[model samples]
Target: MNWTVISDNWLFFLVGAYPYGPLGGLLLTLLLAVGAGILATLLGIGWGLSLTLTSGHIHRLLQSVCEVLRAIPVLLLMFWCFFLLPIVFGIDVPGVLTVIAALALVSGAYLAYAMAAGIAAVPAGQWEAAQASGLSQRQTLRWVVLPQALRIVQPSFVNQWVTLVKDTSLAYIVGVAEFTFVANQVNSREQVYPLEVFGFIALVYLLLCSAVQALGQRLLVKPS
Candidate 1:
C-alpha cells in the first residue's frame, strides 16, 4: 500500500525518459492508438463503402478478406507485421509503426463490419429518394447514405476507439515500451508494492477509457 512508488515514478508512466531519451509509456500508447484509429477510420470507410457499393465477386472477396483479418488476433498481427513483413516483403517497419499497422488492420476490420452494418441499416427509401431527385449513385451515396450511416454508427466508432486505446497495451509485446511496459519495468525494479504499481496503471487506464466515453457522449449529443 505504499503510495510513494507511484509518486516517484509517475513521470515515467506519463512519458518514459523523454527529452533525455526516446519517448515511451502512456504518451506512446496514445500516439499508437490515435494514429491507428485514424488509419482504421480511413480504411473502414473505404472498405465499408466498397462492401455496399460493389457486388458479386469483388464484394465477396472484400468480405472474406475482412473476415480473415477480424479472425486474426491483434498480437498475432503484430508478430506478422514485426517479424514476417521484414522477411517476406523486405520492408523493415519500425516498432512504433509496426504496432500501429497491426492495430489499424485489426480495428479497421471490425470497423468495416460495423460500417457495413450501419449502411445496411439505412432505409431503402433514402436511396430511392436520392435517385428520384436525379442524383447519381455516387452522388446519392455521398449526399444521403454515408452521412446517415456514419451518424448511426458514430457510437460504435467511439467504442471502437476506446477499445483501441486499451489495445495499445498489446504494443508492449512487440517491445514498443508503452504504459504497461513502463509500469512493468518499474515494478521489476522496485520488486515491492506490486499492488500499488499495477493498481496505478489500472486506474490510469480506467480514467482514460472513461474520458473517451465521455467525449463520445458529448459528440453524440446534437447541439442545442
Candidate 2:
C-alpha cells in the first residue's frame, strides 16, 4: 500500500509512455474497446435486421457466423489473429489491431443475438401499423421498429458495453500495452509490494466499471 509509488507512477499506469512517446495503458484499452464496440454494434444491427427479412439462406448463414464467433474464446481469437493471421494472410498486424479484430468479432456476435431478440420483441401490430401508414420496410424499421427496439434493449446494450470495457484487460496477453500491461510492468519492477500494484490496478478497473454502470442506470431511469 505504498501511495508514494502509486502517486509517482500513476501516470505511467494510466497512459504508459503516452506523454513521452506513443499512447498506451488505459487510454489505448478504452480506444480499442469503444472502437470495436461501436463497429460491432453497427455490424450486428445490420445483420440482425437482415435476419428479420424473408431470406432463409441469408438468415442461416448469418446465424451460423454469429454462433461460431460467439463460441470461440476471446483469448483464442487473439492468438489466432496474432499468430495465424500473418501465416494465412502474409500481413503483420499490430497487437492493438489484433485485439480490435478479436473483440469486434466477439462483440458483434453477442450484439447480433441481443438485437435479434430486441427486434423480435417488437409487436407485429407495430409493423402492420407502420405499413398501413404508407411507410416502406426500410422506413418502418428506421422510424418505428428500431427506435422502440433500441429503447427496450438499452439496458442490455449498456451491459454489453460494460463487458467490452472489462474485456479490454485481455488485450494485455497479446502485448497490446494497455492498463493491465502497464500495471504488470510496474509490479515486476517494484517487487517490494506486488500485491499493492495489482490491487491498485483492480481498483482502477472497479472504479471505471462502476462509473459506467452508474451512468447506464441513470440513462435507464430517465423518463422517455
Candidate 3:
C-alpha cells in the first residue's frame, strides 16, 4: 500500500533501462501490442474482405485457418513459436519476435471474425449503389463500403484493442521482458514485497486499458 515504492520505481516500470540500454517494461509491452495489432488488423481486413467476395473454396479455407488459430491458446502459440520455429525452420528468432508473431496470429483470427460480421451487416443496397455510380469493386471497398463498415465496427474494434493490451501480459511467459516480466523480476529480487510489485503491475495495466477505452469513446464522438 506504500505509494512511495511505485513513485520511486516508476521509471523502471515505464521503460526499465531503455534510455541507456534495450527497451523493457511498459514501453516494450505497448510497442509489441500495437505493432502486432496493426499487422493483425491488415491481415484480418484482407481475409474478412476476401470472405465477402471470394468463392466457397477460398471462404472455407480462410474460415478453417481462422478457426485453427482462434482455437489455440496464446501461451501455447508463443511457446510453439519460441521453441519450435527455430528448430523446425532453422530461423533464430528472438523470444520477443516470437511473442509478437504469436499475438499477431491470434489477433488476426479474432479480428477476421469481427470484421466479417461488420461487412456482413452492411446493406446490399450500398454495393448496388456503388456499382451504379460506376465504381469498381476495389474503389467501392476503399471509398464506400469499408468506410461505413469500419464505423459500424468501431466499438468492437476498440474492445479488441483493449483485449490486446491486456494480453501483452502473456508475453511474459515467453520471456519478452515486458511490463509483467519486469514486475516479476522485481518481485523475485525484492522477495519481501512481491505482492507490492505485482499490485503495481496490475494497476499499470488497469490504467493503460482505461486510457485506451476513454480514447476510443472520445474518437467515436469526435467528428472524423
lDDT scores in order: 0.89, 0.83, 0.82
| Candidate 1 C-alpha lDDT tens digits along 1-224 | 78999889889988987868889988988898779988998999889998888999999999999999999999998988888888999999898998898889889989999899989999999999999999999999998888888888888888998999999999877788899999999999999889999899999999999988888777652323
**Model 3 lDDT per residue over 31-125, tens place:** 99889878877877887888778778888998999999999998999988887878999878788788778888888888888788888888999
| Prediction RMSDs, each to the true structure | 1.7, 2.0, 2.1
Each candidate structure's TM-score, on Cα atoms with residue i matched to residue i, is 0.94, 0.92, 0.90
Candidate 1 ranges with C-alpha deviation above 4 Å: 220-224
What's the lDDT for residue 223 in model 3? 29
Q: Choose the strongest candidate by lDDT.
A: 1
* Candidate that beats the other on TM-score, 2 or 3, i.e. the better one: 2
Ranking by lDDT: 1, 2, 3
Write out the backbone clash pairs for model 1. none
Candidates 1 and 3 compared by TM-score, better number: 1
lDDT of 2 by residue, 68-177 (tens): 99999998999998988799999898988889888888987888888888899999999999999999999999988887887777777778778888888898777888
Candidate 1, residue 224: Cα displacement in angstroms equals 9.5
Give per-residue lDDT, candidate 3, residue 33.
81
* Model 2: CA > 4 A from native: 19-21, 215-223
